[model samples]
Target: MAKLYTQESPKQKNLQPKKESIDFILNYSKALSVINCKDKKFELLLN
Candidate 1:
């Protein structure tokens, strides 16, 4: 496969977020896990 990522906008590049906000970081990770679990359940239903 050819290298897939093409380019990022300058704004997108500069918008790197801090990893040190303890509460915000934890909530963000929990949200991702919930979304992933929902997606997996959805795929199981489709089968």
Candidate 2:
């Protein structure tokens, strides 16, 4: 099993999310990328 993050270096330990929380962050990042792409296309159409 993977060890928890507290023992990791100070820089790395800044992110201490649980597995589920990390998964949620990943999903949100992907969704944001898609949304940004769509917004770019809309801007191009407006221009």
Write down the RMSD of candidate 2 (Cα, Å). Answer: 12.5
Clashing pairs for predicted structure model 1, backbone only: none
- Tens-digit lDDT track of model 2 for 1-47: 99786765557647666999989777766555322564473222211
Writing each residue's lDDT as its tens digit, candidate 1 over 2-45 gives: 88696765575466567777767677655553225644732222
Best by lDDT: 2
Q: Which pairs of residues collide in candidate 2?
A: none
Which candidate's TM-score is highest?
2
Q: In model 2, which range of ten residues has the least summed lDDT?
A: 38-47
Question: What lDDT is obtained when candidate 2 is compared to the true structure?
Answer: 0.58
